[model samples]
Target: MEPSEHARLDAYWRKIASEFAPDPTARPSSLLVTHLLPERPAFVRAVGAVSELRAVLPKPKSVVAAARREVEQSYRVDELTRERFSDPDDAVAYLESRAAGERIILLDVGGYFAPTLNELCTRFSGTVLGVVEDTENGHKRYASGEKLPCPVISVARSPLKDPEDFLVGQSVVFSAEALVRGRGDILHGRSAYVLGFGKLGSSIARLLHAKGVHVTVYDKDPVRRAQAMAQGFGVARDRDQALSAAGLVLCATGSLSLRGEDFPTLRNSAYVATVTSSEDELELSGLPAGYSRSAVGEHITRYETTGHYFYLLNGGEAVNFLHGASVGPFIFLVQAEIIAAARTFTRAELSPGMHEVPAADRSTIAAHWLNYWNR
Candidate 1:
């Protein structure tokens, strides 16, 4: 990076560190796996304040050139891609090699390395101090696995994350609107379907409704469906029917909510977007044989199969990530919580299992956030 860019980033990092005030004595060696976007520098700086950052595993789709360069200059950079780590086993092998007998904590997003971290915890018990997961999908991944041997600290469900998720939902809509508008289309007054009524999904659905779009929501969980209905949004009883009728579909579910079978049911010219970070949320590989896919616009891909065609925004990854994955300084609240969780894990003897950030840590982080932003 240029001298000016370096100085600016340094100033920004200092600003964040002063506000978050990470514990200086809680420095655990850590391997960070997350999106490498411009906003990530502050997160890295905050974590580095209380953790010995050994390396970074950047999610391929979320990498921004400038951020990647800065991180590479400061720490080891390992790009997580199919070519680098063919499968979960390969990823595990690489992580083990990287650990090199060090007792390091794993900081992850989307649980991309959950299986690897789980195996490491067993193979080299205690050497893998613990894991700090940032997303709900990662939380679910660790939750679904067999009993974990080390604590898996999760900030996914923290009330502190609500502000970030809320803005994330807004960004999803904003990006979708920009893409649609680029094609001479407008989101206002359009019929939309939101697949998943989870925190992010509900936020997206509500934003779309507020913009005068007719929003229909579907979730496999009956409770979520009821919640959507209670919020006065249309509840989709028949998934395929809703897809066929809506002009836009936004997926926030961290699972394979849309696959080949559902693609053909989409309205011919409809646009699809996702708020989840991983491509597993859409499962484009499930698209039937003879399907043709091509980039139709910046961050938009056109997929055609069985006479049905639709656009996939941001290549089926989180649409908000196309622009920096930021919700402004509020995101640093969650980042601060992650640091606090890491500090707690290193200092306390918590038993192995899924763990939430302690209330005290969250309270402290929230207080700092309020003080910083309210000033």
Candidate 2:
């Protein structure tokens, strides 16, 4: 980056740090793994302000290369550490090596460092402070683990995150629409199947409906389906039927909601996308024999089998990530919540288990967000 651009970015982060300052006493050394988008500098600075930032691990597969380079240059992250971020095992080992004497906290998104969580906690014991997870997928991963040795604080479901989640849903629809329009097709007035009627899914459904797309909502939970129905959305009583009918299918469940087995039932030429960062939302490996796939557009792929074809947006990864995964200024609320969560984890005596960001912390962050933005 040029001097002017660097100065501007530094000034932006400094303002964020001032506005969202956490407790000064809770500055534990931290290892962070999150999407390295341009907007993330503010988050990095916010977290760094309240912690001793040991390493910043950008998910190699998901990070925007230019943005990653900018952050690396701006932060002066060394080449050796940058090399380690490319491999998960190496990243974990690096963090393990850093946990010898000082208290080490982990701030992770999507549980990118989850595979080694157990070993890290087991080996480091008291040295490993805890983990602060940033997404629902990561929260589920840590929650499902067998009795972790340290607290796993989740800001994913915090009320402060609701706005971010809603904006994520909007971004999913926006990116999908942009891709479809690029292919000389229109999404308005078409049918769409939205899997997982969670906050994100529901927002996408409503946004699509507002855009004149006929949307059908499906969820594994009966209550969510009922809620969708109550909200006047067409609930998918038959998953395969819905899949076979819609021209667009969006998976937001953060799991393998769409598998290869279900691909055969999808409408030919249907546009499939996801809202989660990983490919865990769609399982394309189970595709039957004779299936063929090829890139059809930037971050779009065409898959053909059984005399039919469907397009996968962003390689079945989160569609929004292709566009920097930004939710604008509201994301700062959640970032501040993360900083607060990290501070709480280090200072408090929380037990070894899954925990939510305390309501008090959230309120404080929300107040700061309002004050900062309104100012």
Candidate 3:
């Protein structure tokens, strides 16, 4: 280990020395194997005593496959439900069967699943899993139970990047980037109006903020509205205010409450889009000339003459979840880490019930994601 790494580990070890001490008859602490292991494990001796302990990391391919399969399995309850499972009723039946009388650890990474999932959780007497999605809606659900039937599991932080590395040479980092590149629209100067401050909306705000775009947010919930302001976002108390000024309006509220009349004030030059809701369902027919809608892809195409707007990039799904491919791998990885550690600490099986996935697990997951980025 380099001197800095060694020093950092030394301080970490000192702080948690009691947790790593050997127990005469118990399994050795995984903390030792995980936290104390060298950044690059080698056959060299001076590394550390804990480095000698066997450590097992899950295969990234397997992890990705499992997640994809789960997404496929959860077609009904997930927002991607409409695209993947043509029949909503069938999907609901399957979800109900799986959730009946069980504890669920839902790692809601986006706000799409909550509405239906919340109903399912209440109906089946099973808990909804984690609410660690990156939107204000999820955060509000976690903070207040007014709209939720059961308690929230937890909320997630942003994905981690490797401290020492950046980017994969040729691979797409985010689905949005692919769409943006494909559409040839520069997002740098665009003003994005996000209509919601929930988990998913908050995440979108952060991304746009980081990209140097002016982001104005709107949410009726006072708490969420306050939270957005505290984060240095311009909070739009009224939806019209946000819509009239933005170059692009991204509907992130996960609510169908918005109506055609609500957006009549939008300027013809402004593009209308959403991370939630399908283009066909957006009721954009009455939109003025120079507006259009399209699916989420890497690039966006504008059809101003026809009043058509393409929502390209990430399948028009929650921007953050689709960004997970490169920019947010830690989103899932952190949830996995929390699941793993929760399992380890409680010796509990992964089941249904609203369970708190730890934030530390998320940090570790972020670290691993960053490591992958470097490699």
Q: Which numbered prediction scores highest in lDDT against the true structure?
A: 1
User: What does the lDDT come to for candidate 3?
Assistant: 0.44
Put down candidate 1 lDDT per residue, 94-132, tens digits, no spaces.
666676666688888877666555566655523778888
Of 1 and 2, the candidate ahead on TM-score is 1
| Error in Å for residue 198 of model 1 | 1.1
RMSD value for candidate 3: 10.9
Which candidate would rank higher by lDDT, 1 or 3?
1
Give the TM-score comparing model 3 with the true structure, all chains together.
0.48
Count clashing pairs, candidate 1.
0
- The clash tally of candidate 2 reads 0
Among all windows of ten consecutive residues in candidate 2, which has the lowest summed lDDT? 76-85
Model 1 TM-score? 0.90
Question: Which digits, one per residue and each the tens of the lDDT, describe model 2 over residues 49-112?
Answer: 7677877777655666676776675453423323443455675567666655678888888775
